[model samples]
Target: MTVVAADAAVSQVDAAAAAASTRPRCSTEDMLQLLQDYDCWVFDLDGTIWRGNEVIEGVLEALELLRKLGKKVLFMTNNSMKSRGSYLDKCLQVGLPAHVDDIYCSSYSAAAYLDSIGFDRSKKAYVVGERGIMQELAAVGIESFGGPDDNEKRASFSSEMLHDTQVGAVVCGVDPNLSYYKVQYASMCLLLNPGCLFIATNTDARGHFTPNLEWAGAGATVGAIKGVVERDPIVTGKPSPFLMQDIAAKHNVQPAKSIMVGDRLDTDILWGLNTGMATLLVMTGVTDEQLLVAQRGSSNGVKPHFVMDSFGDLRRVAQQALQQQK
Candidate 1:
């Protein structure tokens, strides 16, 4: 699992590309060994587990096997469109054995981050996202407005619309109902209201909502706000080390004894690397082999320790391991 440093004479990009070419593929034996070695398994949801509404093939069985084997299994995602409860419902609907406690989405993380920062409970938050952000904020006793409610407001922008000077923070996420009004309101809050914090659940540029297409993600909305406000928002999701540090503290997760299974190198794999966990890249979500290979030269030396076609492939390894044990 160690990446040997390349020759100093080689260019940095060339050395990284060379190192990537030698990245390990998770063979059946390696998977089995991983099962034996790691006590905890952290999985990314969008790509590594399911795509859109469909569960990735055999992933349910693989998760069941992990639970049966007494491994700690957790699901993490940057998709801020849904709260952890909603995510748990989706998991149950798709026959994935998941508990509410095992789910960690950015919606929940955003709320947690606010609470950690001692955000004024009396102040209101303007949300340019969806019900998920609202739900999470409410759960933490923080008041919020301007989510789906503003979807109906199509009026031209004006200064009078920026009425809520009490808005202490503007939280942006993957807003399917994004509108000019929302962007203007969010921007005005940050610019007009003194010390009004700008927060982003995540900055993922694109998301794999369907098998054939990529859709604009939270980053698009964040970018729109940034354009108007000209200020960087605090990112609370993946690769930030905020949520990971919280997870480690609350869940007793020993990074060295855990493996992070994810699809995107920038977020999932990089987050694991930052937190000192082993990383496995799966190809069922946004990242494909071609993209993976292309990123080698541009990844700034970041590479996953192992690669696999799909997480469901682990079911086969688990089945084989169970048979051997029997």
Candidate 2:
């Protein structure tokens, strides 16, 4: 084939994808019927709720509809860079009525996991993330070292530097200020301490903001430590089931009666599958129809139970149900 022919073929594929995205997998009646089975709604924040600083269209209205229907709603995110309180603030800023109890983030889950294992003030954690990790750890009375402020401003470091043996755990997330010193110190703590714990918030290598844009995720920093220490860290975010464990114990979530709505198939859909809940994929944030089309016949990876053009359509479905009731 000629180069022009290849270009035309590529353009055709793009056009086909554009058309597929505007289509919905389930009818309004079917969606309402399916929603009746689930009492609790668990959502992913980034791609599912909002992208960057902009709230997705119809998300607030959809949430309102769910609330009016008496569904228990909770927000779950794998981005460990912010605390739950911070996330709650973002929700309110975006016109989503949210309570402090309604938000759950990977930082909170990581801290909760630490607290579950008898973590206390007596133990110390060396963290590679930002203030979010520190804030959560402090809430549980766990002391942490090597936060954003602890990072060295200068490149001066040597093996002669004193090592702190009190660090019983090394926790890592997305750290923009990640440096060789942070990696070296975390490696020292894990290497010197015979039973030191290594934990990660999420292993997502990259996050997709739009179909054509992407950004780094927590896995990048976590992988840096793994490269130096040659050991795998315990992941505490989606697909790990740690957050679901807490949600089940506290929120009384029944996996069969719950719905996990997200944009990323690997993290959100896979997480719901791992927890035995139905999953919904939305195209507002990441993972377009082209990718979903490829996974349609596969039995291996987690596939969403339903797919939609965007999260706002769920609100429209709910509105239709209300009209039917009227």
Clashes of 2: 0
CA deviation > 4 Å runs, candidate 2: 1-24, 154-159, 208-213, 297-299
Query: If scored against the real structure, what TM-score would every candidate get?
Result: 0.90, 0.89
**1-326: candidate 1 lDDT, tens digit per residue:** 11112122123444454466666458888999998888889999987788777777888899888887878999999999999999999988888877888888988888999999999999999999989999999999999999999998864634356459999999989988898888988888899899999999999988876644678899899999999988789988887778877778877889999999998888899889988999999867766554566666563756888887778889988887777767
Please provide, for model 2 over 1-326, each residue's C-alpha lDDT reduced to its tens digit, 9 standing for 90 to 100.
01112123434665665455443466777689866888999999887777777677788888888888879999999888899999988888888888887788888878989998886567799998888988998888889978797676434545365568989898888887888878878888999977889999888877653323567788888889999999999888887887887888888889999999987888889899988998888766656556766676465755788877667788888887667766
Lowest lDDT 10-residue stretch of candidate 1: 1-10
Worst 10-residue lDDT window, candidate 2:
1-10
Error of 1 at 54 (Å): 0.9
- The local distance difference test score of model 2 is 0.80
- Give candidate 2's root-mean-square deviation (CA, Å): 4.9
